[model samples]
Each structure stands twice: as C-alpha cells, then as structure tokens.
Target: MDPSQQKHFAVVDYVIFAVLLAASVAIGLYHALTGGRQRTTREFLMADRSMGCLPVSLSLIASFQSAVAIIGVPAEIYSNGTQYWFLGCAYILGLLIPAHVFIPVLYRLQLSSAYQYLELRFSKPVRVCGTLTFIFQMVIYMGVCVYTPAFALNAVTGFELWAAVLATGLVCTVYTTMGGLKAVIWTDVFQTLVMFAGQLAVIVVGVQQSGGLSEVWRKVQDGDRIAGLDLNPDPTERHTFWTLAVGGVFLMLSLYGVNQAQVQRYLSARSEKEAVRSCYMVFPSLQLALALSCVMGLVMFARYCGEDHHTSFLATSKKDAVVIFFVMDMLQGLPGLPGLFIACLFSAALSTISSALNSLATVTMEDLIKPYFPTMTESRATYLSKALAMSYGLLCLAMSYLTHLMGDSVLQVALKIFGMVGGPILGVFCLGLFFPCANSTGALAGLGTGLAVIFWVGLGSIVTRSSGSTPLPSSCVANRLAGNSTVILQAVYSNVTLSRPSGLKRFYSLSYMWYSGFSCSAVILMGLIVSFLTGPLKEEDVTPGTVYPLMGKLLCFLPEHLKKKLCCVTPLGQTISACQRQPPHQKENNGEAFHRNEELDSCLPEEVSLPLVEQETFV
Candidate 1:
C-alpha cells in the first residue's frame, strides 16, 4: 500500500453519492411544492405540530449524531482504547429525564421556542439571554459539523475541501430554508438510513477483509485496545466511568433536555405521549450508532495493528482523517464502497447542520424576531425564517474556515462547545424547573458566572495542551507481516510514564468529559446562593406550568415540619404548599395547577399565545 497512490472514485461511486444529494433535494422540493397549511409559520417551523413519533425520533438521533461522532469516536477508540464507549451509560438518565421532565412541561405550554419558557418562568430578560446563549452554541457547533466531513475526506481522497463544504452547506441551507421542519425531518429520516447503511457496509466489508469477528477481537485484545471500567474518582482522569456515566448525564441533559434542536422535535410531535415515545426510540438507535462506530474502530485497529500507516498519511492529516484513510485503503478495489462511506460521512454532517440551521431559524423567528413584531403576518414571519436560515448558512461557511484552525480532535471540540456554552443554559432551565425559589436575577447571575468559570478552565486546558503535555504513544510501529517487531514493541512499552500534573494546571487539565457536570453544578450552586441572598422567589411569584411536577414529589420526602415551613398559601383558595396535604378532589384539575386560576392566565402575556389545539382548551 504505497502512501503516494491516490484513491480514485469510480463512476459508479459518483452516481451513488449523487443519488444521496438528489434525494435530499427531492425531499425538500416535495415539501416546498406542496404548500397548503405549510405556508404558515406554525407548519413551516414545527410541521404544524402534526409529525409522527418515528420521523421525529430519527430526526432527534440525527440531530446529535454528526460526522464528529462517526469519525471522531472511531479515532478515539483506535488511539485511546474503547473506554469512550461508557457514554452509553449516560443515555439511560439522559433520555428518561427529557421524556419525563422536559417533554410534559414544554409540550403542555405549547410554545414555539424552548427558551420561551424562560419568559414564562423568569422574565423577558432571562428569555432573551437564554435564546442568545443557544444561538451562540448552535452557530459555533454548525461550523464544526459542516467542516468535519469535508476536512477528513480532503485529507485522504483528494476531495476539494471547500467544494465539499459549499456543496453540503448550500444544499442543507436551501432545503431547510425552503421546506422548513418537514423537510428537515424527512431528509433526516432518509439521511439516517444512508448513514447507517454506509457505516454498516464499511464495518461488514472491513471485518470480512480483515478476517472474522473473532480474529479482529483477538487482534484488538493482543494490541491492548480493549478497555475495562475506569472507576477512578479523580475528575482530572479523562474518560473514566464516572466522567462518561455521571458527567455524561449532564452532557446529555444539555443536548437532549434543553437544546432547542431537540426540543423543537419534541414540540413537533402530535401529542405529549408521542413526544415521549419518540425520546424512548432514540435509546436503541443511539446505542446502535455508538456500537457500530466502536466496532468499526476495533476492526480498523485489527487490520492495521502492526503497520506504520500513520507515518505514511496521518502526519499531515487530522486525527479524524485516519478513519477516512482506513476506509479508502480497505475499500480500494470496491469502487462504490468508498463512495458509500463518503456519502455516509456527508450524510452525518448534513443531517446535523440542517437541524442546526432549521432550529436556529426557529429560535430566531419564535424567540427573537416574533416578539418584537407581534403583529407580523404569518407569511412575513415564514419568509423571515427562510432568510434567517440562509444568513446562518452563510455564517456557517465562514465558521467552517475557523474550525480549520482548531487544534484538538473534532469530538473534543464539539463536546467542549456543549459543555462550555450549554452547561450554563441547562443550569438556567434547571433553576426554573426544579428550584421554585430561583429568580431572574439569580438565573442571569448563575449563567454569567458559569460561562466565566468554564471559559477559564476550558481556555486553560487548551493552553496546557499547546504547551506540550504528554502524548499518547502510537501503536503504529509494529510490523503487520512479521506478527510483531521487537524494536517497535519496545518503543511502545518505553513511552509509558508515571508523571503527574500539579496545582491549578492539574485542575485545568481535568477530563473534558467533566466540563458539563462541573459547570452545571457551579451554576446551580451559584444560582441558589445568589437567590437566597438577593431575596428568593416567593411561591406566588413562581409560574405554575413552568415547574416540573416531579419537583413537588421530590420535595415530599422532606420532614413534615420542614414542608410546612416551605409551603405557602395562594390566592386561589388552595394551599400551594410543597407538602401534599389536599384531598384528591381538592387538587387542581388533571394536576394542572397553573391553569386552574384565571388570574394566572391573565398574567400570561398576550403575545405568549398557545398552539391552536391548546388554545381551545384554555379559552
């Protein structure tokens, strides 16, 4: 395998790839041309709230499963071992919390944007702050999403990077802007299948080419690529059981629980039950996605275990480029196979960016623009949404250039964005939902403090890495043909050292996995302390529908006397106490305490209108 030999795509490969792009465009055209109810803002932004659970479920999975995961996860497994797979553990509480806690509140409220809950619960300022934070997070993330696949493919296959970038970015923007949520969801469904098919094809072919499953497993085991549970309590130790499982919970919550990309899908479901069911469907699909990528990494390790391929190509490429190189190398004779894999990569990237563009347009129209222009016509609002989508699409192209300058692995960069920016936003939502005493002042304070702390730590870690920290020893030294090369084996053994980092550097060097958990905790703690100091929100001041019902039950565990101290009487002639004292009949109808009082309904702003279905009930 000469490194200089360029990988060429066959005519068949081009056709296969073209079909994927064409199918995406076709779906967009289908939605765009059929303009009955979809001409309105409601249908354009949220599919008229008529989406089924299946498409929404698949779209939710596609929202987060970007090319970063498809390529970066394998690279992580290949270089650092399979310890990163523990992220699966976090999905348990992750999906459950979103389904049970987030869905009911957000769905029942029937708001266009998830951040709109901030206005209902806290204040207009808090809502604006939340929307702005989300916009920043997604805009930055869209850059990474759009850049990763093109960057990797260019490194290995001589694909024009900027051309690929323009193709994906322009294609996604056009579809999302024209067809809106329906187009995004259906294209995601189509792309998700393509993504799975491509990965599955590569893995199956790679496994057969390398040997059997047992042979690959044996090779991985022999190379020490298999990892066990790392139960270490140290936060600085990266990819430990606690970090992936415990810390990952917060990461998942930030992405799934509060992120508008996912919340928009939840809101699009036809019913609350359908929304929850869609979340449940993500578990198996996501787990399968994780498993497929992990297996592909192990197989690549098996095939190239004793080869110095990194020296051949990886020296000039990103860590993620290694996966593309392996795929190209393995599928060399199989013409259409390479194209399928490349299509898979772009599919992952396109699904994610499309979702981001659509969701960004959604937040802009619903949270930012619509509020200012309350009397704007639906047609004008829909047009503005499309324009916003195009603007973000162009902005994404610019950010993709910035992503080229990034130094870390794509997985770490994406995760860092989720933690550094998303953690504080999640904290704000948590403050409103779980802690009734938190005020808008406390929410704003916590968010600012959280962002500052995370930026300090995140930036410090980047500095530490740039300052020549210890690097992982490469396993590429061994000779594949000779079974084992003693000299290269010795080099691998000698690279291991027992050095430890010290002081503030040690804290900054803490695992990137802990960033979300650490920042979320900091925000929550700071929010509670600031609220208590600056006069906590009264029971009457807290909005009814904004808080989760589970918070009340969780508070029931407190001592009876303590419950009495915390509970308060409301103007509705019902005791609005943390304690459960009222008879079943005396409780608010259907457990909807917020809607029982006409005064509370009056307090809701005129601009904060419910969906048509909910309006009939409320009116």
Candidate 2:
C-alpha cells in the first residue's frame, strides 16, 4: 500500500468505535430483562403493538438506509454525477400511498407478516409464495448489507474483513434474538443518531479541509458534476426525470408499501393514526439523509479533483471503498473521526440486518411454522422464533461471502434486487387491493410472469454491461507535474467514438430504474387479463376487508350504469335490499369495517345483491 493510502487509528478512535457496539448490546440486554418474565411472540415480533410513532418512524428509516446507501450513494454521485438525486422526488407518492392505503389495510388486519394479506385475499398457496419470495429477497439482501461495510473498510483501512463481518453478524443476532422488536427499534433510534452524527462530522471536516464550500462548489461545477433534471423520456436512459420520479414510485411502493420489514413496523405502532404519522415523519429525515450523502460526494470530488487515485494503492480496491479512502485521508490528523465514520458504516449495516433478522423470524414463525403447528403452545413457539432468528443470523453471515461476486454499483445492485423480486410482490398486493375481480389463479400467474420478466432483464443487464447508456466522464485527475496539454487533449480525443447497440441488446439493457415499473405493469396487465378469461371473481365471494377503500371512489367517476356493472357490495353477512342506502353507523358495526361508506349512496344495482341463503352462508 502507498504510504499515503495507509490509515492509522489511535486508542481514542478504538474507544469511540467500541462504545457504539457496547451501547447497542446494552440496549438489547435492557429490553430482554425489562419485558415480562415470559416472552411472547407478540412481544418479540410486534413490540406488543405498543410502540409510539417517533421510534417506529426512526426505525423505518434505519431499516432501508443501510451502509449501501450511506457509501454507495456518495460513490454514485462521485462517479455518475448528481442526476441520481432525483430519486428523492419519488418519496412523495411512495410514502403517501403506504400511509393511507397500505397502512390502513395491513394494520387493521393485525397481521404478523404482510403475506397474511395474500392468504386473506387469495389462498394459502399465494401466501406461501409471497412469503417465500420475501424470504429469498431479504436473505440475499442481508448478505449484501453485511458485506458492504466490511469489504469497504478492509479495502481502504486494512481492517479485518471477516472479523468485522462476524462482529456485526453476532451482535445483530444477539439483540434480535434476545430483545426482539423493541430492542431492534430502540437500537435503530440510537444507531440512526450515530449514523447522522458520523456523516455530519465527515461533511463538516471535509468542507474545511477542502478550502471551504465555495471552492468545493466551484471545483465540482468546473468538472461538470453539477447536474440538472434529465427530462429525457427514454426508458433506456439510466437516470432521467421520468425514470427516477415515476419508476421510483413503484420501487418505493414495493419497499415501503408491502415489504415485511416495514409492514412489521406499521403493525407495531400504537394506533393506525400513529402508523400513518410515522410514515409521514420519514420524509424530512430521508431527505436529509439523501442530502448528506450528496454533499459528501461533492466535497470528495472537490478534494480529489484532478488527482488520479486510481493509479495509486487503491487501483485494486472496489469502487465503494473510494469514499473511505477519501475520508481517512482527509481526517488523518483528527483522531477519532475515522473511527466515527467506521461506526457510522457499521451502525448502518447492523441496524438494517437486525431489523431483517427480527422480521424474518416473524414471517417464518407466523407464515410458515405456526400454520402447520396450529395446536402448538405459545411458549414453545416463542422459543422456536428465537431459534429462527439465530438461524437467519448465521445465514446472513454465510450470504456475505457471495456479495464479492456482484458487479456494478452497489446502489444499483440493491435497487435491481428490489425491483426484480419486490415488483411482483407489490403487484400481487395491488391486485388484491385494487381489483376485487382478480382471483387466486390470476395472482399466482401474474407473480410468476412478472418475476420471469424482471429476472430476464436483470440477468441480461448483468451479463452484458452494455446498457446503451452513455458512460460517465473519467474522474478529474489533477496534473500535479508539468505536462503537455496537447498530449492530454490527444489522449481524450482518441477515446471518443460513436456506436449503437443492437435493438435486442438495447431492449434487454433498459435502465434499471424502470425495472420495478415495468415488472409491476406486466403483473397487473397479465393478472387482469388472465382473471377475466378464467372466470372473474364473484362479488359475493370477495372479502370486503381485502379491498381498498379508494378502489370504489376511483370507479365512481364512471356512468351510474357502468358503475353498477363494476361495483358490487361485498358480502359481509348484511341484509340485501333493492339499492337501499344505509346510514354509516348501521353499515359499519364496528372498527372492523374495512370500508367507511361516508357517501351513504346506493351505487350498485339491485341485481348485484346476493340471495339471502348465500349471504348467510358467506357470513
């Protein structure tokens, strides 16, 4: 290693890092001891459903904002420019829809796993399919989460990679198994603070060391790193306005709307209102997180402008480690800063993996194990749940070994994984909630078809990195020694060429941002078509609680005759009448009523009502 690239840590730096891990373990032990003498699955999985909005909100952010985003976002900005920042725009619809639509439906059901909705809406097979898909997705994702920081720190700072991985895996597993959801959420709260503090410290010190914000801004601008919205409508464009804003909404929906990790948080909230408020709270903090990473990239670009570290000791290091290299170099004189940054990275990884372990255990017990063992005792189930948590922790550690094989930017890789798997899952939920006519067969077919399409595209893109997108300009390497400008100009011009990819290659190479949107649309389209052809669901057979409230109003704009054809009152054991409107209190017997018919208008025709015999039987 080049002498300049080597980083040395002081005792104070080690102390700072140790304190973070100790505090997290302490929090877990506290929760373990403080809960009732006997631990229940509810206490372990849902925090007994007694959590406030603040902790849940913070924990939600911590769940998704792993070290991948912390390090990858900056690396993305540093390499590809700030065009990727437009993903922030998608957060608007992404979270809002979950707050109103997903939160209400799942929270009311009091589900232990989000896949429970699949069984309620479709069949047990569908639920198992959904649960298995989520398990595969999270298991693969946890490996990447655990591997990112350890690999990066090792590359840049000579930290022991296996040691870091084992420490994080063991610590996360201990807390998740010992303390459960309460420990996960509260530790996430503390880790979130540490994450922010560490990043903020780096950004503050980086700006000062780089000769101030004005100089940094000027340098980045000169290098053409300052980006504006890419208004191109091309789906093949990597990071355009439409892809980031519109496609991002689908990605966010897949993650925030239906993913088990977030669904668990929603079910843990004290009330429906609190759950919604917690989602709303995510906006500001998430934006701040995005901004901090972007600014960190700008400062890095400014400091390293025109300096070719690629030819230095870091030539063999992964791209993700570049951020660590710059940080250690900039903070060398300042003891403990590097350690804080490492803590931030590990903090991000640990929080995310801990959440994953707890949620995985919840789904395994609720969706898989408990269903088969209906008569099993609660104490035995709780013990089994803890065992499942430990098992997943081990699995995640094993998965970390595979992450070394992944190609492309880690941010894009993570997003691609979500889009490929999560898109179909979201589509299944959408079919259940938005289209009451969709049956189990259609849902199963749609999920299968969607997954097939996304994997085809995702795998093709990985195999051939010729995505037809324009390559980013090389990093600005400062010419420290006096050099010939003519030689530099000749070398740059020599690399300029124009070539177009084959049509099929281009199609397969469509921007990853469109993966979720395309897959979701494929599922919905295939599902509806298959459902209609294979005998659509009867209104009497549909569960009222499974349908979203907005679906009815969305169809209300149609003509009354058309509305009658499309909309029918779901059978809930109520009396049938000839298009008679009922008062609110009479219609909804209690809070269990999924739909609040505030309009009190008869929207369906008389013929839509089920016979009295069938109505009683359905109830």
Estimated TM-score per prediction? Answer: 0.87, 0.87
- Candidate 2 lDDT over residue span 1-619, tens digit each: 5656678777888898889888999998999999662289888888988999999999999998899899988877887778888999999999999987888667655678898778767767788999999999999889988888888788777778899899899999988888999999999999999999999999999999889988888778877788887898978777889999999999899989999999999989987778889999999999999999999988888887776655785455656788888888888899999899989988999999999999899888877887777777889988999999999999999888767665436545655776689888999999888887887778999999999998988878866775534535545533233688888777666764234456777777688878888888888899888888776765555644567635456676777677657675343334333332221221111223233222212222333233446334322
Candidate 2 wrong stretches, greater than 4 Å: 1-4, 314-316, 405-415, 468-471, 474-497, 555-562, 568-619
lDDT, candidate 1, at 14: 81
Q: Candidate 1: where are CA atoms >4 Å away? A: 1-3, 35-37, 405-415, 466-498, 555-564, 567-619
Q: Estimate, for each residue in 1-619, the C-alpha lDDT of model 1 and write its tens digit.
A: 2437557778888898888888898898899989653588788889888899999999998988999899988887887778889999999999998887787677766777898888767667788889998999888888888888887787787778899999999999988987899999999999999889999998999899888998888878777677898898978887789989999999999999999999999889988778888999999999999999999988888887776655577555666888999898899899899999888988999999999998899888877777766778878888888899899999999889888776545445555766689888998898888777887678888988998999888888876762223324445443254645888677666763324567788878778777787888888889889888877766655655566544345577887667646653221112222122111222121233222222223223433323545423311
Q: Show the colliding residue pairs in model 1.
A: 43-48
RMSD values for the candidates in order, in angstroms, are 6.7, 8.2
